[model samples]
Target: MKTNFLAAAAASFVVAGASVASAQDADAPWEQSPFRCEPGETYVMNVMVSGVEYWFPVYEMFKQAAHQFGCEADYTGTPEYDVNKQIATFEQALAKQPAGILLHPMNPDPFVEPINRATEAGTAVVTFAADSPNSKRVSYVTSDNAREGRVAAQQVAEDMGGSGQYAVLENPGQDNHDRRVAAFIEEMEDNYPDMELVGRASTGQDPNKAYQAVLSLAQANPELGAVFMPEASSAMGAAQAAKEAGGDIRVMSVDVNASVLDMIQAGEMFGAINPNQGTQGYYGFLLLWLAKHPELIDPMNDHAEAGFNPMGIPVLDNGYSVVTQENAESFYWDKYLKKRGTRGIEG
Candidate 1:
C-alpha cells in the first residue's frame, strides 16, 4: 500500500512539471521579437495632452504591441497645452533610458533638440500625429493632414451645394493643425470658388475659445454656412454655439472622441475625419523597435544608396475615414475595439 502511494505522488509531480513548462513556452516572445529585448527593457509613449480621450486608444495600442513583443510600456506627459512643459516631460522620460519612445510633439520647433538628444543616446524615437521634420527621429507616422483637410473641405462644400460662406477656427502654432488649415483654404479657393471664407480665429487648444470664436463669427457673418476647425475639441463648442445661435451652420473637423461621435450621430455635426489611431500607435512602436535593432530585418543591399533606410521609413500615412451620422457608430474607439474582440487600456 505504501509503494502504491509513492507511485501516485510521482505521477502528480510529473504532471505539474509539464504544466509549468507549457505556461512558460506560451509566454515566450514571438519568433520575430525585435532585438530579443532584455527582460527589463522598457518603452514609453509620450504626448502633450496626456488626458485627452482621443489619445486613450493610441496608448492602448502601444501597450498591446509592447505586450506582444515581451517588453514593458509606459505613458508619460503633461495635460497642459504648454510646449515648454511638454519638452520638460520629454527630457524626464529620457532620464529613464527607455529602449524606445513614441512622441507626439506639441510643436515642431521645441522637439528638434530633444529628439536629437534621445537618438544620440541610442534610444530610438518615433513621432506620431505631429512631427518635427528637422529632428533625427526614426520616423513620423500619421494620417496625411493636408489630404484630410482637403477631404473635410470637399465634404462640407459639396453638402452646401458648392456655394456658402464659411469661417475657420484655427490652432495657429501646431504644425499639423496649420497644415490642415492651409490645405482646407487651398481646396476651397481652387475647387469651390463660390465658398467664401469670411473670418479666422485662433482657438489654440481651448474649447471655450472655440465657442466664443464661433459665436462672434456667426454674429459677423450671419450668412455663414459652415465652420471648420483643425481638431475636435473646438467642434464641441462650435456645435453648441451654432445650436444656440439658431443658425444652419454645419460643423466639421478632424479627429474623434465620444462627444464628437455622439454629435455626429445626433446630426449636430457635419462629419469628422478619423485617422486610424490604433494603427499609428502599433506601427509607431514597430518603427521604434526596428530602429533600435535593425538586425531583425536586414536587407540585401546598402539602404543608404537605396534611399530606404530601415531605421527611418520617412513618413507613413496610416490613412483616414470620413465619419458621418450614417456610420458614426463605427468610429468610437471603445466600441470599435469591442467589435474586434479586444479591450482597450484597462485590459
Candidate 2:
C-alpha cells in the first residue's frame, strides 16, 4: 500500500510544475506529519580524500539515518588530499542544492566564506571530524582531538616505561591533526618530562614522506623510544621505518584503517586513537536535519524577535576508542563491511 501510494503520488507530482512544488515546500505543515523528508529533499556528506577507508563507516551510518528520514543522501569529495580541489568539490555539491551538507573541511580558516555562503543560502552545513570554528556552520561533530592525543601519549609513554626519547610526525595545517600533535607534545612536557620530544617533521599525511621522516629521525635519535603521528596513513610508513631501523621504536598514531589494524595485531605498531565515526555520522545528520527544519522548535529565546532559528548546538563530541592488539580483530574494516553487507564508501 505504501509503495503504491508513493508511486501514485510521484506520478501526480510529475504533472504539477514549479508552482505546485513551491506551494508544497514553502507552506505545507511538514511537522504535523511523520518526521520524514519532503520529496526532492537531499543531504550530502562531504570530505577530503574521498578514497580513504576512515570515511566509510561514517557514511554508512549517515546513509542509514537519511533512509530513516526518507531523504536522499550522497557521499562526495576530492580523491586527492588537496584543499583547493576539495573546496571545488564542495562547491559542486552546493550546486546540487541539497537540503543540507555534512562537511569535513580540509582546513579551518579557508572554509569560513563557503560555510557562511551556504548558511545564507538557507542550506544547513554541519562539520565533522575536523572543523571550521569561525564559520557559520550549524554544528561541528567529532571525537575530542586533545584527549585523543593525551591518550595516545599515555599509551606510548607507558609502553616506553615513561622514559627515553620520542618524536612526532605531523600534518601542520589541518586543525584536528595540529591539535592532536600539540596536545601529545604538551602532555609529554607536563606529565613525562623524561620522554623528550627530540624531532618533528611534517609528513603532510603522505606515507612516503612519513617513511623518510622516521628513517631520518631514527638515525639522529638512536635512543628514540616511540614515534607518534596524528593519523594512521603516516602510522603505516612510520611502523615500517621503525621496523627497518631496529624494531625498538614503538609507533603510536590516531585512527585505524585495515592495514593499521593488521599491523597492530601483528605487534608491528602500537594502538591508535580512533574516533567513534558511527556516532559522528549519526549525530551529524541529526544536527543537519534539525538545523534545516528549525520551524519544529520555538524555544524560550529571542529567536523570533531576532529572526534566527532556535536550534543551535555549536559542537558535538562523538567520542573516541582505542584500538590495540587485543581489540584489533574486532576493528578490522573487512569484518565490519562483511557483517554489515555494504559496499563501504565506494557507492
Candidate 3:
C-alpha cells in the first residue's frame, strides 16, 4: 500500500511541474513565445510626445488601440517641451528596434531624416499633434488646424460685428499655432474685410506674457473688438486682461481648458474651439493599430497588391467643438472634474 501511494504522489508531482512550465512559457515576451513573430512578425510601438496636458489624451487613445491588437506600446517624452530632448527620446525609442513609432515632433525639419530612416528600415512611422510634413510617416492623426483657426476667427468676427482691431496671442513659431494664426488672418482678409488684425504678439505659451499683451492691446486700442488666443493657458490670461482693461473687447480662443469653460459660462469670454480629447486618444490608437495589423483593414486598389499598408493616406478629421454659453453645460467637464478632482477642460 505504501509503495502504491508513493508512485501516485510522484506522478502528480510530474503533472504539476509540466503545468508550471507551460504557464511560464505562455507568459514569455513576444520575442520568446511560440506566438511571437517567426522572423519579422512581432510588432512593438513607441509613442514619443512632450507633455501630458496638451497631447497625452491623444497618446492614451493610441495606447488603447495597441492593446486591442495584442501589441506593446511605450509612451515617453521630455517633461518641459525641449526640442533637443524630444529628438533624443525619439532616437532612444528607435534604438529598441520597435515595429512602429508615433511621434509629436518638436522641430518638424530636424525630425525629417530620423523619421525617414525609420520608414526606410521598414518601421511604420506616424505623426500626431505636431506633424513633420516632409517626413515619410504613414499618416497624421489630428484636427484640421486651419479650419479650427478660421472657425475661431469667424466666432470672433461675429461677436464683434465683423469690424474692430484684433490681436493674436500666439505660441511664437510652433507649427500648429503658426498655421492657426495664418488661417485666422486669411479668413479675416478674405471674408471680414472690415475687421483689422492690429497685432501678432508672441507670448511663448506663457500666461503672464499673454495677459500683458492683451492688456497693452486693450489699453492702446479701445476699438479692439476681439482678442484671439490660440492656446488655452493664454486664453485665460487674455480674458483676465480684457476684464482688467474694463472695455468692450471680446475674447475668442482655442482649446477647452477648465478655466476657459468657466470663463465661457460666466460670459467673460466668447467661446473656444474644443477638439475632443478622448477621441484623440481613441482614434490615434486605431491608426497605429491599423499600421501594425494591415490585414484587419481592407486594401486600397491604388496601392500595390503585395504591399501591406492598405490604409491609403486616410486623413481622420477628429473634428472640433465650439464651447459657447448655449451648450457649455453639456460639455464633459463636470464628470471629469468631480471624479478626478483635477482640472483640464474644467479649468
Instruction: Give each model a TM-score.
Output: 0.87, 0.90, 0.76
How far residue 274's Cα lies from its native spot in candidate 1, in Å, is: 0.8
The per-residue C-alpha lDDT of model 3 at residue 114 equals 89
Model 2, range 104-215, lDDT digits (tens) per residue?
Answer: 9989998999989988998999999999999889877788899999999999998888899999999989999999999999999999989898999999889999999999
What lDDT does candidate 2 reach at residue 270? 78
lDDT of model 2 at residue 13?
31
* Cα deviation of 162, candidate 1, in Å: 0.5
Find the candidate with the highest TM-score and give its number: 2
lDDT of 3 by residue, 1-347 (tens): 44234334333433464465568886655444322223433333333334435454555555555554456666767665567777777788777777777777766888889888987776777676567888777777667789989998888887777887888888755777788888988999999999998887888767788899998887778778788877787888888888888846788887766677788898898888877765665555555544654543454475565543664344555667888988877554555445646443212
Query: Can you rank all candidates by lDDT, best first?
Result: 2, 1, 3
Q: What is the lDDT of residue 230 in candidate 1?
A: 88
Ranked by TM-score, the better of candidates 1 and 3 is 1
What is each predicted model's overall lDDT from 0 to 1?
0.83, 0.86, 0.69
Tens digit of lDDT per residue, candidate 1, span 260-340?
Answer: 899889888888998888877877776777677765446677875764446566777777899999999887877878776
In model 3, the worst 10-residue window by lDDT is: 33-42
